[model samples]
Target: MTKFASLKSVRLAGAAAIALLAGAAQAQNSPPGAEMATEAYLRAIQEKNPVLHAVIAVNPHAKADARALDAERKAGKIRSPLHGAPILLKDNIESNDGTATTAGSLALKDNVPGRDAPLVKRLTDAGLVILGKTNLSEWANIRSNHSISGWSAVGGTVRNPYVLDRSACGSSSGSGAAVAAGLAHLAIGTETDGSITCPAAINGLVGLKPTVGLVSRTHIVPISHSQDTAGPMTTTVEDAAKVLTIIAGSDPADPATNDADAHKTDYAKGLSKDALKGVKLAVARFYTGYSPKTDAVFENALKDLRAQGAILVDVKDFDEAPIGKAEGLVLNTELKADMAAYLASTDPTKVKTRTLADLIAFNAAEPKEMVWFGQETFEKAEKTKGLSDPDYLKALADSKRLAGPEGIDRILKETGAAAIIAPTTGPAWTIDPLNGDNYGGSSTTLPAVAGYPHLTVPMGDVTGLPVGLSFIGPAWSEKLLLNLGYAYEQATHHRKPPAFRPTVAP
Candidate 1:
């Protein structure tokens, strides 16, 4: 019994839940370090919160550490904002003793790195407990073009707690949805592109995609060293700031982290409800007007920011020039080399797919894996030369030129903005099995391709689905964007838990 045999197993179970637990709804709403809020439902789903609980250590760790935090509170010491909190960690992040760092693929089942990813260790030291591992898109959704976001061959499908039919968003899907569904107060998510921000946006959680070097990637699964980074996904900007402080630093193991220690602020220290005052922001108009409804939410958010003393500049000069296509080329070329290196270091046995080629073969053998999407992305990557290739070099150069200096940097320099803003993504569309995702434009590509930092706060809602307002800026600007985000979050308070709709009938 791997917990769930199918998605339909809990459809009625979830719907019926809202009916019987009317009174207990508010009772289950316990904050991180608050007194026990009458453990009505949280206890029942402690270990059974399969998709949301990212690690298996939650029970033992939560039991012991939570009490310790409570004792500290009684003794007048609140270790940190997340002092008595529980968090889920993505499968790929290393845990010193308890959980294995498999990246949701069987190839590295025994590849538990025997130490927490440096970022993970810092958070635990700050008093956050590792509850369990949330399933992720296998190899962070790099396996095949047809790959599903939340589905891993080892962990199966991590259903959206809000809707049994809709997607949970990949790579960091579990982490995003877990925190959104209240399985944990926070979770660790890694991203190369839309991995962290996309999921967080769609799931209505706050996600911080730090600059590539801000958080160490050591002991975690590798995507592309140039783009991969770890970040926090939490219910609030304040909590996200707390987690960022604990996890961010330069690591000797990850050379890319050399500049991180000096860059990241105790981000929480600067979070203020009034920091949005007199701030200048530019909106990438090209990324907007995709969905009239999402635009409506974003439009309202603009008004809110203005009311809060922020200036919104409708910058039409921001480039949207075919960046995604170019970035795809670089990802394919780099994934082949980076993933191969990571695979070579892992144990071969017990691994479902070893090399990228082997994984392709496995998917071919199992049609279900190839049914939803094709391995086109993986196949293309296989054909790409190493980063040293002239074509690869050209694509990389063009990306930095267009997405960086000529892109975000150019806009910031011209506007003198504290940050640029956009709709993180449109509202969650109806899940279409035949055609796949039908969402609108996303603001992730620019920041993602540039390896710059991007943070999203709740904007508002569209037919009850959440919309995220993104604040993107140059490297190490996470603190500035976070402060502006915190100010907006505190002022608007747009975040709301999902109602678990079965499907949005179109």
Candidate 2:
């Protein structure tokens, strides 16, 4: 659950981490006389304010890495910040070692790969140890509209660390819950849209939705080539920056990058404590004025920012989301094609159903999957032609024009600000098995559709269920946003772990 190697790599890539090591040369830097051992990390989990074993302990090797990290720290030769950090990746991502890479379905339960995903490689190269894979919504939560967030056939349902009765949110559900519960310091999460941020927001952690190509999607399972991305989910902006610096890079395997004008770098430099000083920003009040309780929290946050000298501008003109409709069309057209292609690349000899149509048939044969939620999204997708379809081509064109030029670009140009801020989402509602998520306000659809980077920080709490405040900007604005988020996090210090109550009595 910890990202020790990434923690160490923070210094490896940034000025601060190395400086710490430089000043304290020949001395163990984990903590002042800290015990670096498998026992300590396990004890941390054992004594977690809220237990998080279900999401992480299934990975058998997590303990071994903890021991190694402890040994290295004792020897005064820690590999990186995330070296001994126990990290649980979503099951969809490939793990070269012993961890299984099932995408939350029994179908791919044994679909282990021969190599670690490119993102995993970057993390490990930076000294991150792969503890094991955490559970997720089956197939990245793309199956059913009625599908509960965080419920996977393989992992069952991931309960919110705060209130167990509430939905943990989906796809990256385990990552958010595990990190918030102190099972690990950080986790790597993927998102086509709300997967990462939703879980993180509701779990009281930071979620970064990197620009489409900021991190590699080479070995992870896919939904849309246009929107699929991997990012850091952590307790603090500093921690997210620590891991992001390593994973943000160009990858040849993911050709969508050829057209991407993304800014990839060690984004941790933006973690300055005073980043909000005199920084110009716009608040999309449209994303606000949702929940009365959330409004109170947002106003308080605004007061804090104003006091901190963030030149705030009120923006009410943006109901426009770039590539808005185009994004949906793009996903539908791209999914069938991209998924089929990806399925073909896997170890076909072992896979039962490769095509989306095959999956539909399997679901029909097994009533449990199709009883309530059906793959209507998949059926719609399967009916569409390849990326060459005139509709898809137009949608792609519309996406660029709207989400990029008319959307984020226009806003930045009008405000002349470094970034835009809004309510990431409203309060977490009661989890309903008979129904799906009770989402209130969501600001993810904009930057998410534009293929731009977005970072959401836990601004404050709402009725005890965590709600996040979102900050977004043009591509590669990760550093600027990170600095702002870090400054706010340090200023408010709002993050708190969940209490795991069975339910919140309304």
Candidate 3:
């Protein structure tokens, strides 16, 4: 059996990577050579990642890759605006950089496929350096309902950068924390529901969970094919837009992305501070009032939008109970099928857990895997019938319908709004391993199940823990959502770097 190395032990590899870059010769100062910038980022990760537990493994080849990119830059062949920028990927995203793409699961510690996921390929082709893999909730937080967010057996618990003892939120916990702490220029995070948005909001960054098919899901660890997608988690909305433009294209391997090329555009170019002028936005009243403090922050955010000459309409009558029930069945059914498919695609010798059942048995025998939480959710997924089962098919259809045309679109038509706005989620909660995550209100479900684009920008802080304001639109409306978010972000710059305090006072 392959044993996963400790996160502390992994730091040694990152240290060696920095050491390798220390010898790179042809360094430039104009906009900084890729090698120079990569070395600085590696140093920051080496210094801060130990405390934050945000990085799973640093790309040992990063400096070499940076050197190559610098050579290209010297040849006057720039790739994109993000040329030479170092970006971190959530651990689930595969790359051929020698680091294993563990979903923070010991079962996949040796699952180094030596191939880049389609999105990673796009990033590297555009001259972005693959910095490292960020830790995530084990199996993207689907192991159990009682499982703790940001806690993984392989990488330990990812500490929130703002209030170290609070939840960073996952399974994009490390990506959010890493970028918030300035460990990377940008990070890629995948979301099924609130993974990207919650973490980015709580960590004081911008998170975009694009429409389901807008980005390729090939080679990623799977939960549900219907809802999974990789998106940008960055400190600025423009950075998110820049990343989206590069990664949003059709992948032959992913049939869902067949229409992606048609919808893809230069998202960053569409951003303008005047994008919101005269635009009417539907306020998702249904998603507010979870936290009084969060509501207060949201009210101020609305005022900011109003000050920008925008009309806000309150949309209060939306029920999520049926959608929640339907989504549960759909996710469970897809998990059993999709996990098996992803496992089969892995190197058989390296990954022995080839099926959901195998994973369940492996977890039962692995003491550390169960130390923080049980695999009750896995058990539930295992019991689910195949995808062709009528119950599951019905659930999938109903979920998409109720959350899409009948939900978000209906609200938009009735309110005459360009997009819907709400509090992304409440502030970070205290990290309680024994009790698990106490998540508050979230506006992730409607857009998530609907396969619509959702963007979360830093709104403000509550007791020093940051929160985000959400901008949601119909499917393939990523460009519109990004522009709206950019406008708001410019009008009220609420994002700030984390203080890294041990805890926040009540």
Candidate No. with top TM-score = 3
Native-vs-model 1 lDDT? 0.74
Model 2 whole-model lDDT (C-alpha atoms)? 0.74
- Report the number of the highest-lDDT candidate: 3
Which of the two candidates, 1 or 3, achieves a greater lDDT against the reference? 3
Give each model a TM-score: 0.86, 0.89, 0.94
Quote the positional error of residue 60 for candidate 2 in Å: 2.5
Candidate 1 lDDT, 100-141, residue by residue in tens: 776866556666555677887887777666666777887898
Q: Which ten contiguous residues of candidate 2 have the minimum total lDDT?
A: 5-14
**Relative to the unseen true structure, what is the C-alpha lDDT of residue 21 in candidate 2, on a scale of 0 to 100?**
32
Q: Tell me the tens digit of each residue's lDDT in model 2 across 319-395.
A: 65444567778888878887787778778776777888887777778765664466777788888888889989988
Error of 1 at 232 (Å): 0.7
Estimate, for each residue in 371-470, the C-alpha lDDT of model 3 and write its tens digit. 9789999999999999899999999999999999999999999999999999999999999989999987799999999989999999999988999999
Off by over 4 Å in 2: 1-57, 69-78, 257-262, 321-323
